[model samples]
Target: MINRRIMMTSLAAGLIAPAFRSAFAQEWKAKYPELIFAIIPEENASGTVERYTPFCAYLSREIGTKVTLRVVQDYAALIEGQKSEQIHVGWYGPASYARAYLTGAKITPFVIEVSSGGIKGYYSVFYVKKDSPYQSVADLKGKNLGLVDPNSTSGNNVPRFVLDKMGIDPDKYFNKVVYTGSHENAVLAVQQGTVDVAANWWNSDDDSNLTRMAKKGMVNKDDFRIIYKSDIIVNSPIAYLDSLPEDLKAKIKQAFLEAATKDKDAYAKLSDGKDDPFQPVDHSAYEPVVNLVKFIDGLRKKNG
Candidate 1:
């Protein structure tokens, strides 16, 4: 009965494997009873908390550990928290994630957003009030420029890269270059005449920071116009520390991948239903963005 014995062994292995995995998961769960998830301050702290708490709840349920949201003041704080390993998981813009990775954070990107259009990339745009005389970057020469945080992707890094490519050094080209601190603030600066033009993220005419702000009645979409749009940059990614166990990372990733279908309400709150779903991604997908951030760093160093 050699065949019968082999079948019995196979079935036993199959049964033991799942139990073994369950036990292993329990061990890690005990080790990490709670996880800290940090998000960059794309909006005000309250808004950030409101948007992510439900998602964090879903993650906690899926991972069998407490997932707490850590809202920081700015992108640098989030980067620093992750670098020190105080933050286990983080949602980051492309440049901020690259900055964290390049500056000694042992993090691995695991999921990226797929837009409702099914695109995995977004553009950095220059915005000006609709009635402003600035029709183009050339029209805004010697005017003020508003940027978001220094670590922002579309708000700072991509805009810097695009301006450099056009032989426009912001310091020399603008009368003043101001960091407005957030995309919403940057847009407000433009609208209120604090800055002549502001750099911010735009996915499409219908889906962007401007559109979201419009929905909140914070800014009228018709009050501004886009002056410049950069080449499509890789979408933002959510990453976790590499020190986390392999099985845990897998579970974290699977939870995100399943979030759209399994936790539709939370997912909708995240992007205002503008994005399709979270898709699997890896470090390789962001290598180009890393290089872009490095290039921007080089410019800063040279200019300094």
Candidate 2:
């Protein structure tokens, strides 16, 4: 005689097996019905919207899942989403990625929007007013310098790292330092003479932020000069949560790399008309960023 409890338990298991099997065999679509990608609105607002719309559409078609793009107000929002595992994919700057990786977010399928000559990196330039006596990094000694933000790679990390290599400690070298919160703010601070120097990232092309400011009459091209430049650091990276299923991770990576080459319009939109193409990359490629963070930590200790 079968016990009543045993009979009920067996019946439930029998009913659930088919459902489990059906889900398992339903391909990646049924696994994650909704795929969400996050981007920083401040850093890449227009470009992000333009690129991700069609890209998500294509990805939805290929993976048979509902892909949605979400934009956050700032880098912190995107980083938080990645930490909570709420975001499946993200486009992160190098310093932001380093901070996330330190907190356990996984880096995968590193890709960069290229410019001329298939470049993966950009440089940090220190700009000062033309009439200012500051002509080079050395001139900033004992003068105020404006940094965009502590977590900013091109604005803060790169500038700090370059100064360290030159045997000049930013904290000790500058008479005062201010955090402007954004690269645009930093540029404005320098242009207004509120700060002695400002640091930012830009390609060799003349049509960058610097040029825009020059064009808008906010600042003249001849009015400001580059006082210092840092070594090229890799552009921001796209990262995923480590807990994602390995197969799903592989498919996402494959999709991005292939899209850059296979979809010309998708690639162009992502690159902002720059000659950038998505190329395969790995976590280890960001070693330089890690090293720069370590150098920054040392500076913090010294300053403290």
Candidate 3:
């Protein structure tokens, strides 16, 4: 009789567990009502929105809350949005994420993109037109240079870091230095002769800003060449505000981890169909990048 009583209690608890979870989820949804996920534009604004919208919808469904997407105009805006907490979550490049953390944003990184090869990083590269005379960094002296954005990791920080290591001050080395605003624009600057060389991100010959543009028929990939490449940079991460309730953070992290299998279409759209599922990450993974941003900031202060 005691054994029967215990079994019935266990059965009752099993039935109640899911209802408890459902109520708990609704509790946070009522508090948040809507969550904002901000992104830095690696592509054009429209393209960035289209690519990320489905992923936002997926998160909304998984977390039982409304998740909306915001494509900030530039990396700095994305950083500021998070710093101000107007943005609840952000997809940040390594340097941009570091910049936010260093500037006093209360945020924690949760997931990083994994390449289809299962690698967790990518490279910054310099692209020049195929028919151009510039053959190397030295050959490009006095030529115009295009960088993506001030807060860009592959587009600005890593390139500046590498150039400094080589004793090249871009301001003194190039006749004119311009921010092209986005990686796609940086590549377009090269093709359009607005800039002789442009710094952009590259994952492989098969996966990169150039290749994506090529696939879209925006540019013939064969018409350009990579004149320089930086060492691997830790892949970009998806980060959320540390101020969020603990359970919400857990839900957001879980939603991202399971999105690849649970929402393959959204994952593929965000990844350009070139990456694996999101993998867990944290503050430690980005310390090197934080130091790198600090070093770059130091250079700017010294130069001024």
Clashes of each: 0, 2, 0
Q: Clashes in candidate 2: how many?
A: 2
TM-score of 3: 0.93
Estimated TM-score per prediction?
0.94, 0.78, 0.93
- Candidate 2: stretches off by over 4 Å: 1-28, 41-54, 207-223
lDDT digits (tens) for residues 114-181 of candidate 1: 99878999999999999888888988888999999999999999999999989999999999999998
lDDT by residue (1-304, candidate 3, tens digit) is 9999999999999999999987977787788999999987877888888899888999999988899999889878988898898999999999999998998989999999999889999999999999988889999899999998999999999999999998999999999999989999999998899999999999999999999999878999999998898889999998999889888999999999999999899999976899999899999999999999999999999887
Candidate 1 local accuracy as lDDT? Answer: 0.91
Q: Which run of 10 residues does model 2 get worst, by summed lDDT? A: 39-48
Residue 166 of model 2 has an lDDT of 92
Choose the strongest candidate by TM-score: 1
Error of 1 at 22 (Å): 2.4
Model 2 clashing residue pairs (backbone): 114-276, 130-223
> What TM-score does prediction 2 earn?
0.78
Better of 1 and 2 by lDDT: 1
Candidate models: Cα lDDT each: 0.91, 0.75, 0.92
